[model samples]
Target: MTSFGIWGLIPPVLTITLAFITKDVMVSLFLGIFSGALIVAGGNPLVAIINLTDMVAGSLNDGWNIRIFLFCALLGGLVGMLSKTGSAHAFGRWAADKLHTQKTSLLMTWFCGLLIFIDDYFNSLAVGTVMRPITDKNKVSRAQLAYILDSTAAPVCILVPISSWVITVMSIVKGSEGFDALGVSEFSFFIRSVPYNLYALLTIIMVLVIILSGRNFGPMAKSIAYAQETGNLYNEKYGPAPGEIDIDGDVNADKAKPLDMLFPIIVLIVSAVILFPVTTYLSSIDGETITSVGAAAASMSLGDAFNNTDASMALFYAVIFTLVITYIYYTVRKLFTIKEASGAITDGIKSMVPALIILTMAWTIGTVIKNSPADGGLGLAAYLSDAVVGGGFPIALVPVIAFALSALISFSTGTSWGTFAIMIPIVMPIAVGLAQAKGLADAGLLNAAMISVSAVLGGSVFGDHASPISDTTILSSTGAGCPHLEHVATQMPYAITTAVCALVGFFVGGIFLNVLAAWIVTLACFAAAMVFLPKILNN
Candidate 1:
């Protein structure tokens, strides 16, 4: 392996640091990308500039990035249109009217987050924006909202069999040499292993427990109390006014009807679900199957569909369906003047500008890492695994390490998909090899699978949840109307608590349960967190 020294690592580290300090995610990421390009180009000034431009252009042209941006822009437009039409406010007001209790409001938010499990990015943005007003009306803090959104996105996606993320992971795994040796079909293995993902199961349980008990701790507790006292959970800038429904002052207060909000949300969900089957069927034609990520990417690249007459054509059709349905609703309901609707879409795209810039930089960083001498990220993991596995540190710690390493890479590059792509192949083979060496080939395969998958999910989510350059985190803050760092600060303690408990669970299970150990540890951690968290808050 080649060494790029500390110089190779400096750009990503500086990006994250600056994001934390300046709270300007786009600026931080752009600087990170520029620095990486500078490193790659070295002393050639012209080459450095060209490298930067090419890095960004390549990223933008990537099918994955293009799809992500398209979805984001369209979703942003949908969200903005919903808000402007009074649909979001109307739905929020109606839901608030019906769910009189705080617990109900929280539960609804939790359920909504879970329901939007088709895609994490969509879940984070759409769920947070739609539910923010309702949560705020009921006095839930932005920290809590961010926590719910972040917690649910990756966890729920990992658990869901047909989600875009699972498809991507399975594709990566199937393509690996390890899977061929093991004779395990990617889809079947993914389905069989879902139950063993302790982090996903435990995190969901933990989120529900926090919601039901109203148990806030650390920064979350402070945030909740502050919201209750001031009636402004979204921000300190909004002032300490009580929940006042000023008919004239409320944006979109008068025009919104219950169905106006309900219809589009319902349509969005239905469209996504319906498109899944359509995309799958289309992908199966000519033996060219579209995985979840591929479907999304193909759907965004409609222009290609017109020429090639390929499976990606289904995606183009779905895009058309989305536009037509959205347009019909807007026009039939007289939601906005044609001009207003146009402006709303423009504003929606404007809101995504910052996200688009961050994404471009994130892609550039990922490319630089891939092309660098430290191409494979396995050195650190291999060293740690070798040092710890024989030292009797406990098997549970394996997943914990996986999670931590995954988190580190994801945070550095600000892309969970890239982290997953890099880590799965490197880690799984080592895990299987280690288990086989212990004369536990059968048990080794299962254990390795659990640990590798858990690590990937946990690490991917950790970075996505906390990193300011993370698109999901940024979108959550934007949706909740919270200052980005404020959301990060307020939610960090809760994430930490869950992480610590998860580590403990991994250990207990590893030493005792073997394959079932993940579940055993996860349940134990969930129970302990539920019991102890409230008391800690009281203290």
Candidate 2:
């Protein structure tokens, strides 16, 4: 789409390459963004620098972006306060006794990741923070914890219909061409596609299999072996982990109760669940005089409210409310004085500084790739989408092609939502047109559409799961106290294994036009891999 043609690939490629080679994400992202800006500026270095600054500023200027930034910082504060009060350690000690083994501890971590499925952002940060102390006590590597958090975050969010991811996905589905022709609502179509989302289902199953089988492989195996033998939870060569923050308050280990930690996390989760609908309702009446939640709720169904909700705003409100309640509760418990608590909160915010910087850079670089050439971007998404749409694959390969294409775009761009926005529009028409050309009836056409859509969703998640520049991936590392690149390095093999299985399933399913056949083959591939790949790779 851009005059730059293949040049659009330079930014993300450079960023990812430098990240792997130098292991400095910040510098890599900056150079990547700078390169893209230079291309957009027609090789004017001065203009590129100015454009770069403005682009990052533009990303932060969005209300949603700012809200997410604040939410992450505030969540860090809450985690810090819990740690300062010794509540996190107390809960860890209690959980360690009950869990009794490394396997159970990791399983509990996986379970917690699944339970907090409302939002991937919240799921990663909250679950990792709450589960870290326990995982650490059990000697599970931070890379492993981060992988679970990263794996569960987007994969679980995309699979669950009642999640932050669903609203975006449903909206995309609704606007997609030929979707209305099917006479099926977006929500129903989404539900139907869930069973076809082999990557997510298989990735989730892979997590359980890895834990239950205790068969680690690839870079992950080395990390696990290192942790088990050296008693070091992370690779020390990567320097101090990203999420390690020092609290200014004295530890209250002996006096702290596990409830001190559990109650706040409960409140955080419950409040988020309740506030999502409430915030959606309120946002719909932003310009009106409606001041009451009751009035807003009376006008629409709970499902409607959730579908229309502003997830970032809802989470922002949830974390703020939790912090308030937690402060009061900690005060009542005499965990710390107001001044000490304030210092802990301040230190917690400081801990998030690195994460904030990485996210900002990631957003800016994404902007660089997404913006049109005239607007000082490489238009990478457009370029990639155009290429895939023009590829002219066989009709039966649409589902698998969509899955692989979506993964490439998402990995290159570092944003799954952006991938959905681009791919769904492009994939829908292709799949529908291909089915009609094959003289398929309504049922066959619908099957093609659903499979393609599910493939896009799953593939998008795969890229987001694996990309180092992805926000969820960075947040997972921050949350789990792992080095960012270490998480990516360790998780890629597992993500790739699941993706390969999903690809095989989509390929066979595309041929048969059968969801059951797809699922069976996917499971079969995963099972076969589980029996063989781990042993081979670990050896």
Candidate 3:
């Protein structure tokens, strides 16, 4: 009903601009939400404030959003437990001795992120908690550490077949006629799409380029220089004062063993993995009311198990289990009293307060912008994208456009999963129609569908990586104990460079429709960009 159309982009634009100006993300998000409410309420200031309050409260009511908030709190407590037990310190000391250089320290962090491929939330918090001390000793700026943590979080998750991202995408792709007509399973389609996901691939690879080359251009370079030269891990302008970000555990380090920390973390990870199936199985049982265990097990493979899996519940229950395990183990070891364990949980959850607030604000603005059409809010973005695709946008350019559009939406909204939800339905049907109109072979049509899917996944991840308001981005900064704005400003340059290279890859792939040819050329393009862009930017 609000016919703002393309003009509806103003709210997000204002939000981003205000963040840089005010240097306060909360105020910026509030202003952005108010701007949208103003448009919806036809410029009535009082009604706009009312609308703002309602929508923000509504964002909290959504189950997915609440789950994320609770998850972050639990993850914070876990990190605190590790810190208090001196687990992170022991590992940090061991790693620092083995790594002995900035590049190696960074690589260790990246590898840890990659290893935790099950979920992005786990990846960001876990890697940051474990690697923070090593990176700090190696003179890596918290911003650089934040960038590494973020780049690996979503990008690595998207690239793997066995991750939360894959499950989400498969659910979207399962109902798509484009993928269905191709005569392949949704999971296979997702796997096929991985190679074409240029944004994700480039992002993962670029971390190495930044590390090995040591050509840190842009704000990141300045940050690293300041840290390496002065032994200061954070800059004065964007970084918090030294003591403000500290969440170190409150216990003596003399008696702490690495196992005190490692045991609980291991339980948490394994429990999460096992419970994914257990949770899904229980749901299926409730829905089907099956008496036969064999029948229930068979039905689980309809590929709906992942969809049925309650990720939040599983995570919550798993972490709780780990805490129980930790409490017992630490008690037996006489490392800390029961009171101390409770204190660590309290301290950890407290540390995550800033991140939770930022995430909630970001989600509120996203709700205002992406509310359903029937809700009578600003739904202009989808309309704007529809116009481009429907106005005879070329078939060859579909993947490229899909990638770019998805990136823009995800960037503005600060949620990759939300971006995927919006783009998958829009782009897939177009990809199919284009292929059919061109009289493509079965293989070619399938290829086209896969390309479109890949574009959406890649673009969403890329945009989320760059967006300051993104949950993963916030988590990365929080985990690194870096000032969030500095993390955003420093990583923007690196994310943008990889995204540019990926754009070219999508464009070329769209033009030719040959996966091998496009991949070869794109890798070359990425290498060239990585080699030359730094010199160009440095100059």
User: Which pairs of residues collide in candidate 3?
Assistant: none
Query: What lDDT, from 0 to 1, does candidate 1 have?
Result: 0.61
Off by over 4 Å in 1: 1-42, 63-65, 113-203, 213-255, 283-320, 371-398, 405-493, 505-516, 533-539
Give lDDT per model, in order: 0.61, 0.79, 0.73
What number of clashing residue pairs does each candidate have, in the order they appear? 1, 0, 0
Clashing residue pairs for model 1: 396-506
RMSD after CA superposition, every candidate? 7.9, 6.9, 6.6
TM for candidate 3 is 0.66
lDDT of 3 at 1: 54
Best by the lDDT measure = 2
Q: List model 3 lDDT by residue over 261-289, tens digit each.
A: 46775777788777766766765665456
**TM-score list, all predictions:** 0.65, 0.66, 0.66
The lDDT ranking, best first, is 2, 3, 1
Decide which is better by TM-score, 1 or 3: 3
- Candidate 2, residues 132-205, lDDT tens digits: the string is 88888778999999999999999998986545466557655664555666656565577678989999988888
Displacement of the residue 240 alpha carbon in candidate 2, Å: 16
Q: So what's the TM-score on candidate 1?
A: 0.65
